[model samples]
Target: MIFGNPGITYAATVEVEAESAILVDAETGKILFEKEADLTLPPASMTKMMTEYLVLEAIEEGEISWDTTTQISDYPYSISADPSFSGVGLTQNQDYTVRELYEAMAINSDNATTIALAELIAGSEGAFVKMMNKKAAELGLPDYQFVNSTGLSNSNLGENYPEGTEPNANNLLSARSAALLAYHLVNDYPEALEITSITTTEFDGQQIRNWNWMLPNMPGYLADYGYEGMDGLKTGWTDLAGYCFTGTAERDGQRFISVVMKTNSEEARFQETRKLLDYGFKQFEQKELFPAGYQIEGESEVPVAKGKEGTVEIEAAEDLTTPVKNGQEDMYEVKYNISKEHLDKDGNLTAPIKKGEKIGTVELVYNGEDNYKNLVTGKTQKTAVDLVTTSAVEKSNWFMLMVGGVGNFFSDIFTSAMDMVKGWF
Candidate 1:
């Protein structure tokens, strides 16, 4: 597919801790914008989000409970605080509720809490890491790895895992992977936002400030564009991962995800995240081109040989929506082709069709101008339709039967028999 779109680039702000970025709409999975979203980079504390995911999964499945408590072990990192402003004064025997640990893990970015939870969940951080990798595979995030639950820089601990001959980074992730992890966490678990969005909270009656300064302190990220429905996410930083933040916002039932990684400084990460989010919020508007369960245009209706009703309805499997910069709304042109080989001799649609099953495709031809066409693919979207056979029993009124097969039950019985004897023929 050829996309005749205007050219656009984010190279202007290309510098510092940011190695790559990607902007996508959560509601639509539409890639409104992106820049090297797939490039893998050190994730730092951002890896905790995946840990959050596993923990939540465990809790929801009754493997653990909110009230369930675990003992904090004396891991090297969990025990030693730089005497800096850190949460978790974790001692060897101290116990914490699963909910409390989750808060510590997400709200305060407590690496120690993460390691503890990971260790308890799988009996050891190493075994838990296997869980993390398994979960990543389940979620389809390929460019991520968790050697340890705590996302400490890899350069410090040399490779101790397999024979890769590389350093043993406690955890590593990409901008896209981070966003995906946070996306599922935020949307799937409302409790996560209830924790991460809080500026401050008490655990054992001590106030622990959220590491993600954007929540209450950073003015750079406090955009009044009505926040575009901004929601709570996490922030990350390290000598390796640099300054990174994953942000999400929703508006009018639409959600957008933006990932800014490797920013030079803490402030720079927020600034770049704001810039990327602004570009996304400004450049694209998601509009539905079609609706689900709606009849497919230019399709055939099934003919009934010995049934009460004559025909049934068929439609596209799912709704279709496209994201495009403003004024480019009308730029998408749909080109359709009919496949007679897949249809019966008559113009009526045949049965055995599933929802989202493909009857045909719609090729979106983009109006190439500016840089729009150059950046994204031209084919706008694909369309699926179901093939269902409908008929009515005995109808006294011919016109009414034409409308709904006698508008009665005799045909319904026939349909039941049809299903039963479907394989008979």
Candidate 2:
């Protein structure tokens, strides 16, 4: 089945306070709302979403496992020891497992642990940077560049910067690209959420908390920003890139992924995200516009040639249900697209047609003044359902065909003679 944009006209009802922002339907990847979504900017630690994705992928491919062990290098050790950067203070001589480091990076935004995981997977941070960019391309991210695994400015790495990158470069992504990346992450590896949803955990005998304040059960003053249904995403901040967040929430079986870049403060990012999510949940609802086996009037049957029946009935193969804006149900119309391959030159199905045979497709078209396009593919994707034959059509007996042929031959001559006589008058 094909999925399309919601029938409601695309409009932003909420005032999102951010440099760039986007809201997407997690199930369909549809852009429900966007503002300057294509403008590329620093993603800061939010860049770790790509790293998290690659790590999950590696574990799935058997190249590594959560139990895989590796030691911290001098570069990461030095970075970890710094109080200014988010880290758990790893020592060079100690061994750490992938699961330990991944939790720190995902839940706490631990920069040093992120570098350790990158090195473990690719043998060097430089090689992991290459992998990140290649995967970004494979994922169809429209605007993105990966300079390092942890989303730190290369200059911050000092002389230890990844071998192939410029000294001062930072990771970059548009709001749309970040949203799409988050969409693929949660959908492709849903297990990742199990780790990301943890609000706090222990590392190296010290308590560390997730940087995403919107998560439930956040400790201390962070609890004021708690949002229901919010879970497992990343947040980022740097002098060059202001506060940014990629947040996901699920309520009433509907999930939405939202991105806000360059907000003024940590609290502001969550505040803006709340606005986006509220607009999504309150403004729309899951609706079944058409039921399975629904037949369209005047276009539900196909003529059958030389068969026992003159025509065969067709209906939708499945239900057409999707997120629809409240109070806009009448803005949708259906269009039938019969398959020419299944018909002869006279637009009739051939004899011996089987039951439930697919013969065409039906699409739902939005009649609203404005229609939204998909974030990945910039086109108005219409929802389509398969059209199938409801019953079988058998070939007529040869004797019956001969009798009909004789009747048609005399009837044609009599009609022609009558027309000629009338013309003489």
Candidate 3:
């Protein structure tokens, strides 16, 4: 289950044919949907995302400039020269600037251009693979390993490697890890989207077309496959990996990242991702439950035991934004549960509480099922959001409690006398 919803059943209903898939919110890190997302698989050309990330990060750190040019080495040239490989058509000893090479790698899925950039960043493809693995670990990816800067496996390596190096060092990534990689790629360096979105560009005197089929105006595929707001990401295909895509789109202020792996056909990858994007946009919306420092909707102020103030205000530590399904907004409920220890025997908050102190937790629930309903049940329930308060409830003095107690005492005595007179009559 993802985001506390039944993911497998939902994905099947949507006709997602991929072996592994996931859709996530770009900003909130919420998993909207997923199916077999943790299974490891070959990434094919989609591995270039890491290649693009390291290069862009280096540029950001002032370690390298965009205009810095590098000469095409023999290894990279061999890969590009082979007619069987997808490349930017680089010739040996030819020099291309960093930005030019990156554009080719990202938009065209050029293996040779990627290796050249990898070598420039880490001095060798093998060493760059090490960097990729290190960065993967830093990103908290649960399962991932990189054998090469390029996604090519040993059998596909052809004659492109130096002696004594492992040829089978191919890149492996799970759908979860791929989505996380894409998340960091767009969040940390949104500018990369600018390059990935390019439909066509000139490199080495030849026009290169982007491999991502989801973009509009891609010749034969545009009419059936194009989607708006799909500015970024990469596509991959190999005999072992099948068709895989990591796509991101933005509409209004929201952005989503989706990954589909091991689909039946190239077109199927983009089509499946489009279904996920549509589901994300149409079914749910980000709603602000409470603004920062605003009092929780139904919770009462705390009565302090020994403070100068009669009552202390209760408030959320920060803004609460939850993505709820359409037409199910009324089913959204916020519950504030405070521990018994934090309150006196009379159920009033105790004194000596600090501001922002967590006296309780805030829970958000949505009551619905596959077709959507307004009723809350054990089986169909989902938690849309959860937050812990550093100080949701405040401390107050005993004065307010004593005053309330005296009023209740007089009211109870009067009620008893009235009941006795009615019985005698």
Using TM-score as the measure, the top candidate is 2
* Per-residue C-alpha lDDT of model 1 across residues 1-425, encoded as one tens digit per residue: 22344343323322323678777666545555566777788888778888888888898898988899888765634333535426566665667888888887788787667777887788876688788888887777757877766676544433323123236444667776777777677767767766776767887677776765555442343422224355667788877678888877666766677788888787787777777777766667777655554443554354432234455444444555667666565555444444555467665334434334454544344553523311122223332333322232332254644656554476788888899899687
- Report residue 46 deviation for candidate 1 (angstroms): 1.0
Q: What RMSD does each model have against the real structure? A: 9.8, 3.6, 7.8
Q: By TM-score, how accurate is candidate 3?
A: 0.77
- Residue 140's lDDT in candidate 1: 70
Write down the TM-score of every candidate.
0.72, 0.91, 0.77
Q: Score each candidate by Cα lDDT.
A: 0.63, 0.89, 0.77
Which of the numbered candidates is closest to the native, going by highest lDDT? 2
- How many clashing residue pairs are found in candidate 1? 27
Score candidate 3 by lDDT: 0.77
Better of 1 and 3 by TM-score: 3
Over the stretch 352-373, how does candidate 2's per-residue lDDT look in tens digits? 8899988888777766665667
Show model 3 residue runs off by greater than 4 Å.
Answer: 1-13, 159-165, 220-223, 291-294, 335-425
Lowest summed lDDT across 10 adjacent residues in model 1 is found at 370-379
Which sections of candidate 2 miss by over 4 Å? 1-12, 396-425
For candidate 2, what is the lDDT?
0.89
